[model samples]
Target: MEPCERARLHAYFSKIASQFAPAEPAASFLVTHLLAERPAFVRAVAAMSRLRAVLPKPKSVNAAAQREVEQAIPCDTLSRELFTDPDTALNYLESRAPGESIVLLDVGGYFTPTISELHSRFSGQILGVIEDTENGHRRYADVDKLPCPVVSVARSPLKDPEDFLVGQSVVFSTEAVMRDRGDILHGRPALVIGFGKLGSSIARLLHAKGVQVTVYDIDPVRRTQALSQGFVVARDREATLAGAGLVLCATGSLSLRGEDFPHLRNGAYVATVTSSEDELELDGLPDVYTRTAASEHVTRYQTTGHYFYLANGGNAVNFLHGASVGPFIFLVQAEILAAIRMLTRAGLAPGMHEVSANDRAAIAATWLSYFNR
Candidate 1:
């Protein structure tokens, strides 16, 4: 975006910043994010309470953004290290957080595993956690016990922005792939795994682009929903993989595995819309198919007469191939701010929860007032 446009967006955020203050002051907060490049966003969240440390994604960090964060909060408060690994992130948190009066502001559920450790070590004083991804929310479901409240926007009605952006990313990536290999999407069959918000959006996007789409979801309700939406629903994985020209996994679970590779058709392109490397099972790719045809973002594997393509090397293909979510991202940031505010409320029950409908609607209405007007 142009500098003038960036400044205008930041000004809008600043106008709405006061609407999201925490009810009770937090001792500290640990934020795990890839969008720390947005100085205005970082400063807005830091203004909510005392920011203990930031666990920024290595891919998202820039010298200017880091400087912005340091200038907003004390330099000593921000950690220079990126939180990529679970163990390292846990260790860093354990050392810095005093345990009591701390909240986790997370995007990928990187802190899910450490929640138990933090609760045990800190005597259950961890305030709460705010998560923004479906993959991260899944981790919360697996846990039988949670010492503090956890709110997720991934499963909430407020995820309209993310849903819209998911479609946008797919369109951009599909166009790029087609440009590289003409008419790849023309009259081609594409398989989409998972029928949740992101998956459903992707299926529609591809269908609108004239690619035949078949959606697969483990949930009977989701499968029914996909079918009702006028999209073909796949009954089995092997069958779907056999006929698909493009296979995209948006399922939060590890949908693609090592054994599933053999099911893929020759000249097929497989990519992940879901978060993390495990979603696409990148470890399963054999070394023989090591030809890098389209930079590190796209991997090519050929065996005998068959060729297969992997987008973003099993990472979230959208981020690798398309631009950021733009203004829609601020909606999520606002949701995170609201979640933090909710955490300060008295008697919030422990366990996974959605950011209340009231909070979501308020943010949406506020956003529309600024841009929709």
Candidate 2:
């Protein structure tokens, strides 16, 4: 993935700021996002609506980001704590006026309070919620119905390119990890669980990197798709792990566990790009394996018979180890702006909703025009 040109970023987001107008205007919004660290992002969002408060996630914030938030967003409008800290996030939301029409802007609702607590505290003030990641979409899975519309970029068609770019980032970072550990990536067998959009890109990247890659997906159609792409498709999880020197999970599902550790090859390394630790269960293995901190983001585990590793403690390794995908993030920001605008006016029947085809086209056009310039 290429570094985004700063000039293009400013011009593109400035155009976004000029064109963005929510049909049913919100009184205010409490945005919980990793992008809050970017001054351009703060400025663009401020142009869209009355951004009441911002809860920046820990992983996305650094010294520079903290300075940017302080300098760009109003002190009264920014939460001091990491939004992932649930108690602090709940407290901040609780202090707000119940009657204030607020939209929950987030990547995965990490900063937002629980759905039940949100309704209890804010009542009908929650105009809607917009989420941008697969894990965030899964958070609402158990709800029989939602109080307001949910505009999810993760569930929408918008994630197609984003996940592909992420796959490229993954291979870049994974190669670094492999090199650090003295693992010969080329000619080594690898297992990729889940043949979804993210997994497919990963499989393609791995193949390009000269790894013998096998895919496992429960969805029969996805499995067939992988097979059609000329990659080996595993019968199941066990079949996938067998003799695999590297394993990566892109499935949002909680599929891997410590019990399955025995199935892995002696020197296999495991990593994940999903938002949850569920993709690679760390419960029992965390205690049993002798750990080695390879870096701030990479950790290695050694057992008597095998060596295993967990990237970013089983969190999304892309953000943890590699360069930030600024261009792709800008596209999602555009999608988010459009989603918030649509949700304010549209009466979506709860659950998860897609960005309208018109909105998608407009976003694409905006990005293409900017890129072409």
Candidate 3:
């Protein structure tokens, strides 16, 4: 970690903590975090502690870093045991802190179901939920009636900058993975699946890199947006897949299923921007295809007539090389903190709500002032 970056993150964390610290610690937080040993995240966790007691449920992918965070700030033993097992995590949380007001501070909505269960099992104990990722926000949105008030910073304008930077990181990581295999991205026909914020950024960045970018989106509006932006929008998904040399899946959902794999151009490179295997459904890959290791970060799946390359073992390619979005992500993190603070107050009804615009503007202005200086 760069010293300047660490210092900036620490300063930003302090600013958020000072601004959002509750008058009285109102709720204990059950936090789902990617414990990636990133300075921005680590310091954010520390700042959350000032607001209330936080039970950090480390995403299973980064358990080693979870141990580092645990050593830095003691977490409940049960939170560690049930980190991957969501079904039991809530039960354990209830048992550990009986009658306490708990808030679900979630990433990727991994605990959405658990929060629902908590609401049903022990009503009013769950204060509210603060979701940080678009994927998670959608999960909560799908619920017919949320069990508690849910505030999300996932789609806030403050997050747009972070999403754009994440898109850049994804493409940069993909290029690095390609270079390792003696390949280049310049002038290659690439298909980008999903034309949302991150997907649009990826498509635009790829085009700027001299890659012929073809975009596909289930939403006709987004496809039109891509077309208006001057990228070729695919009318026939299979035909577009057949023509592309590279495929980047940015949709946080299962954009590519196993049945769709055969349409891919032979030796086409496929990567995802989402952290999980939600983008490419490799489990549905046909049995006809055999898998082989192409490199540390690349996997090759082949059949007699068709084959495609999976980068970063179907995980987000950006994470393969330390998904560095720099201090920009702190803006979104600060928004999540502000949401948590808002949840502590009364009068937020049960349903999905956006982080207040005032909070968003304040956080962004704070970021610009600090980074600009």
Candidate No. with top TM-score: 3
lDDT of 2 by residue, 132-177 (tens): 7776677755456666677788866666777888888877777777
Candidate 2 lDDT trough over 10 residues, lowest sum = 74-83
Compared to the true structure, candidate 2 yields what TM-score? 0.86
lDDT (0 to 1) per candidate: 0.71, 0.70, 0.77
lDDT of 1 by residue, 1-373 (tens): 5798777667666655677776666755545443433667776677776676666654434556677677655433233233444466556655665554777777666666657766666632677888878887888777778878898877776577767787678667755765565546776699988888888888888888788999988899999999999999988779889899888888877888877777789877887765545476667767555566755466777766667787766666666543477677778778887777778664789898777777778888887776663
TM-score of each: 0.87, 0.86, 0.89
Sort the predicted structures by lDDT, highest score first: 3, 1, 2
Q: Give per-residue CA lDDT, model 3, range 1-373, as digits (tens).
A: 5688668777878887788876555555545445464435555644554323345432234666666665655455433235345557656665555677666677667666566667766533777888888887898899878878989888899888889998998999999999999989976799999999999999999988889999999999998899999999999999999999999998888888988989988878999986545677788888888989998889899999887899977778887766767667778888877876787774789999988888888888888878876
Clashes of 3: 0
RMSD per model, one decimal: 3.4, 3.8, 3.1
Better of 1 and 3 by lDDT: 3
